[model samples]
Target chain A: MPAPLSRRHLLARGTTAGFFIVAGQWLWLTPREAEARVFDPQVLSPEQCKALSILGDALVPGAADAGIAAYIDLQLQAGDESLLIGKYLGVDTPAQTEFYRAAADNVISLAGDKNSMQTFATNMASDSLSGWAGPPASYVLFVLRADALDVTYGTPEGFERLGIPYMAQIKPDKPW
Target chain B: MVSKNCDVIIVGAGAAGLTLAARLAEGGKSVSILEAGPERKLGDLVSSQIWARKLKWSEPAVSESGNHKIGHAFNAGTGTGGSALHHYGVWLRMHEGDFSLSSDHGVGLDWPLNYEELAPYYDQVQAEIGLSGDSVKERWRPQGAPYPMPPLPLFAQSRVLAKGFAKTGRHTSPLPLAINSEPYQGRPACHYDGWCDSGCSIGALGNPLAVWLPRALAAGALLEHNARVSRVIRDANNTQRVESVEYLQDGERKTMQADRIIVAAFAVQSVRILLSSATEQHSAPGNHSDKLGRYLMTHPAGTIFGLFDEETYPHQGVTAGQLLSHDDYDEKDAAGGFGSSQWMIGHAIKPHDLLGYGTNRPDIFGAELEPWLKRASRHLGNMTVVCEDIPLPENRITLSDRLDRDGIAHAHAHHDLEPSAAARCTQRMSEGADILRAAGASEVWAGPRIGQHHMGGAVMGSNPEESVTDAFGRVHDTDNLYVAGPALFPSSGAVNPTFTITALASRQADHILSIN
Candidate 1:
């Protein structure tokens, strides 16, 4: 088997606040630290990017192999379909851009003018919920869930990462 | 000199044609099989199975407007082993009523022979080509020799669904499938990889290309590929004797004289060839009854896909589990369904297939789809509810005025569901869905109607006036011109028709051998 397609081509991008920790990763954010990720590249800010790198490392642990920051940087620069399970839903994309912008505004509205992006994260994090079978939001939940599934079920590393065991037998009489 | 010679000759290769010539010496047979299309393989099965229009067939037969569209381009096999190459291998026998439709239903015509007459043929075919199942479970199955091989094991989903049917006091039996459960004959057993429709590379599933064609070749039957038989030639003195067949090989006109002939090109294409051969000189017998391509019938089935709290592991086994629920199978007298069809459970499904597969959930994309995807990863259990469509005259196949590249007309198929038939399908689907729910599906969804299993057109029966062939699949009024395959079916029972097709094919082969 040729080696699986490079993971260098895929990663995650998250924008919000509360010192988002990408956990394990590297970044060349222009700004030194703090408030770095919040700034868009089209409106690049060196001072803000330094802080964003730290935020990037906190969102996911072991983002190093994932190359989260560089991956997002490349994707932001390109225009192909995201290939994210979210993309196939026929939702997201340009809609996500406007949605994220509005969501940011909503957080701003809820948190008030004095609240920092960091404060908004603490508030949004409280919105955690339950029941995967619920409608509407279930779709979004399904996509995010699909991402975790894509990692855990679809890839060998994801399987290993999740401690999922695979049976080698084919045409088995019963499911284990 | 008027040509009466050919480079290679092919007998019925299940539509396996030109490609077989490559294996045999090029200019071999006094005549080769006149295949209408290229032999299809795994790479070609990629199109949507739910939509017949998207499938492979001759280009000319599809039409802009017609009451009888042959669905020819999609239904029949083109290349070698013809349509035999592209079939789903769920081989079930027609109930006893399948033969006596006229006496029993008073709607469709009847066969001269009954299930008992075809029973030995079924047994022989099962032996010659392995079919796997537990026939004892089929309470409604006609008296026949038991299947040669054991049934494929059911997964967790099928077992669960069985429990549901049991709860409702309904029966679920193993479907008599053409796929191998344990290895038999010379082929290995099925890995149960669920790749049957793509043409099994391993010979477990009984495809003509993998089974009958090889035996026919071993017996010295020749095969031709890409050599499209334009028409059947007749001698002027006695038109019934098929003296030769005209074909096109690499754009060159070719002809061959054969002692015997059989049109195994499938229902629609068989009729298409007959229509095309009805040029000025041989036009009399071809369309005598206007029944050459009429009375097309296919089982219009409904599907149900359910989502549960657990991952169903749909990819773990065969496309269909061994069990089938036949409570509704023999309901020709039943007022509910237009005709009877059984319920088969827990088949494997793909993530990207157009209907029912997980890839279809892209709509519930957001947070909603995640749980279902996760749930389906392990817990999706589904079932198929097959109900027979009454033979409607309007649902027929006819020659399209448009011609093929060789100037031969393509068949146009006309297919539609009557209100009563559609309602029957709906009731069957509801019952099936109830069975699934009873079996423990948290969420369930059934289907839009699909091309029921292909049947009809050029059907065989007793009388020459109303039918294309006589019992034993011999074309009427024409000696040596036998018709085989499911095209000989007069009434299609709601079950999978492939087993019956093989039974008749074996019967025709035996008859042919006996005559020779």
Candidate 2:
């Protein structure tokens, strides 16, 4: 059997064009450049939304462009009416807002070094980040990545990007 | 006794309640169903997984405590059809041994009626709902009527995963599904787009909306939505006879008198209703023996995932998976295990959500995430292992001290898997990985063993001292009160409980009709 694709090679190919290469260091382009700027979030504070966008984009490329922050903010504002997958995974509907706010605050504190988003995410995944508090960093990372995936690759156009057929019985109007 | 407004009042508009309502109404009885959730129409059944969350249980959450907490929010549904609206159409019958758990192995409670008594009802329900499968190929399946429609065609994903069973010297058969493979009756055929979890809008899957609600409406069964039933009220003169049902509709406490009542609001809620009926005058009905909320059971289930070299195109078939292997279903004494188990193979998975390929793997993210997910979306092959849970009295559902906004006590489920049942789950998961590897999977991984089909709590038995209900699902303490759903199950069989729930409800309806 052929060897598994190496991480280094995958990253090398990933940084070619879509990524922002600044000062010989590759960084994910901020979501602000891709999405609309004049947006009013209902639930998340400005800082919390920014942190979510940055962390979400770092975890899943193009998630910001897919409106990850807006999606999460909309869901959080919906309270019990939220369509988030976290509702099914033991996170109560009322606590969903606090869960995201706390995680986003933690992300802002940890991701201070803008040079390496991947390294920051790796530390979050392993829970090796110093002074980490609240719901485990790994869990937050998992939920964020899942939310990002929902906005990015869970739609018909997103399926196109992954080369999978979107044989939806009734197509969704938007990713929501 | 209070004046009666209806002959029968069903607490929930779910699979069991709706089925019973249709049957009872058709038999010239006035039936009224009180549903807690908002009314759901076929057009409301959107195909988006994100939008599909609307179909799930939205009532005040059921507090859970257990080694394997039942995914109640995900598993239980709300609205007109209840949980069956989002069910994946995996219709399966319990093996004969499943009926007599204590009689056969001295573990768990035994059913009041044996498999022979329920077999005819099962056949009748299968025919009524229109199941699809090859009965002959299902060697382990109990004797029953053949499926009305042919089995759903295996998509590329199931075909690729079937190779794993073949390579491992295991047998597989077309999964018996309540979905229509071809146009049957007035319902259209399943387009095989894998959207059954989002509620089959095309009326192909035999959800309550497609199978029972139409018949119920046509039969003039009064249906009320957003009506949260509080408790069944007993007659002031005689506590043995239920008089009426008190419920909250439009934020007003209302009482609807009925000659008979059936609580079919799934397991925990059904038990909660009974437990909440505790008044100053009398203890909750069926609590005389303190067995009303005991033996709460849920199947120990988890998915085993693999990435095959072949382009499996894992997003093709139904969400319930395309094939089933019940080879060890009746082997309660298998080595290193104490219960039955089965594998549902080749689920049509998605990129997001709790069970999605992207979410399960938390370790893989950032640059490596997209590539891995893209590959997994195409090459992934996954199967779910469902193992029987031993019914332990300690694994119970009780009324919690905590109250919801409506001031009603919440239901709390406390479950701990028996060691033997846990052992069975572990053994099956190990075998699942091996099967995937044998099928030429380069990598194989398994998800955490979690709870599936919730049952028991108010289980049925011949002895009133040991169980809450009788053979016909009539509560032992009351003459007109019945429990018609998986909540009446005495054992947690390693199969989806909807088919059996429908069957039991059918039998209960027959009994009720015959008496009147």
Candidate 3:
């Protein structure tokens, strides 16, 4: 019943949602919608996504449910057009996939029990984690935590939850 | 392999390029502007921080290395309005002493001309753009015409923050901003929604899209988006004159011949284009004296946050901040440190993102963040501290060995904060925390100091041997070549550069029209 979305509509709304493979067809959807549908990530591996979701949720509560992994995976697939917070934090889009993959591996390696994951997060924040490889643990922790924040608390709904006003002149159509 | 010819070709469509394009085209010079980014309209100025990243510089990533990186990707922007599209509208003029830094303080490079010479241009540009402020309260403001409109209204956050300045024996004045306070020049008044950094969509903010783009288009100036200019080509007959500009557009190489050329591609990219143009026959357009990409500068700025017991909703104002204090700005040679500093008080902020309070306190996370964020949403007060950067020859933009898909070299910016400047920033941040404490903050914290605005690289000066461009932004060795934008700034004056950049470009436009 809805007309097909136009480029002008997307620009006017400033949607952060992207196209994802749903039932073997490309569908424009929000990261939360993609996560609910269990859409396969185009760039990150299943193992990597699982690791990221677990660690991201551990870093910020409800991040996994808010689709942090799907949001990151979708942004990574966008390549140079990625709008992830990492773009502003010195990690360019071309190098983002590798950064996330290595960081996910590091998170998976240290994550075990709930208490252990919490300690690992603390250690990661302080850059004191043992056997941490790839980018500095503190920097990776900061980026992943920021990504989680983006998915969990950066939308109008999230602003409502925090008792803050989302007084947008041009509101985004979808919350990524 | 398309070729086009025009009387004037500007290699950017930002605040500087658009200002020049509008003036030159209206002056009867056929003008064409080549923008590297995609076309953008007022509708494209979205109100989300995540979507706002699309306005920033993305690809052929600039390689940065130094103790303090210039933050090229974050500070620079793409699309029609360029970086000004996402700017916060903090328009402050450089003090008189800022012009003669070397002459007065014996540090940093001095502007070729004094504030007296540039004051008229500043007045002219502000009138065209329409600034809002209480100039009488801004006692530190240089001799110039008052702002066109009254300052934007103060909110609870600013009212709470002003008490701190008063308690600390400092004065606070309404921040001079390019955002409209009322319906001025047909633009709507600001809603004070804290969306300035996400680009003002309602034309309340005086971005190029709202001020000059329409004027340029009406004057018959041509604008080409996604035209990535590689370099300017010197004429075979006259090495001192640029004949054409080579660029990539729509997957094909193109050439645009023009009688006059202006590189207004921000600071880093403007320097990069000149650096890439070097050949055996001639040095880069302004590099004959080896000062093409030297004296790179960015303001060493950071934010100070406080948790107040009073209910202070921090999101009811424009993002730039409500009040300003320049009490310590004029004293460049003070004891504990060197150079000027300012306080942009009571910034409207979000819960997340880089400058957000949540991100500043990286230690608080997991179950602890939400409650803290909910509390701070109604009880937080924050302000930014901007300190001057001492221009150093070693902090420069140079061509990198790595090439893009088009074989164009990447720009590598290296900048390290001077010891005295760093000391000054540190000292002021400490004072800022004390001010917040004096206002009865339960807890206080400060964000990491980072590079704010980019400037210099192709600095303007009187001596051709010591600087890249003349006071009018003409390249020393070229008759038709000029450089615009903040790239021509010889010193970072601890104030926002957009006003100065716009004023300087207006003066350049006048000079160009007069000569023709």
> Better model by TM-score, 1 or 2?
2
Query: lDDT tens digits, residues B400-453, model 2?
Result: 898888899989889899999999999999999999888888999998788887
Model 3: lDDT to the true structure: 0.91
Q: Point to the candidate with the largest lDDT.
A: 3
Q: Pick by TM-score: which candidate is best?
A: 3
lDDT of 3 by residue, B313-362 (tens): 99889999999999989999898798899999999999888887877888
Q: How well is candidate 3 docked (DockQ)?
A: 0.70
Global CA lDDT of candidate 1, please? Answer: 0.56
Identify the runs in model 1 with alpha carbons over 4 angstroms from their true place: A1-176, B1-12, B15-31, B39-55, B58-61, B64-75, B284-286, B359-371
Deviating ranges (above 4 Å) for candidate 2:
A1-35
* Full ranking by DockQ: 3, 2, 1
Candidate 2 has an interface RMSD (Å) of 1.3
C-alpha RMSD of candidate 3: 3.2
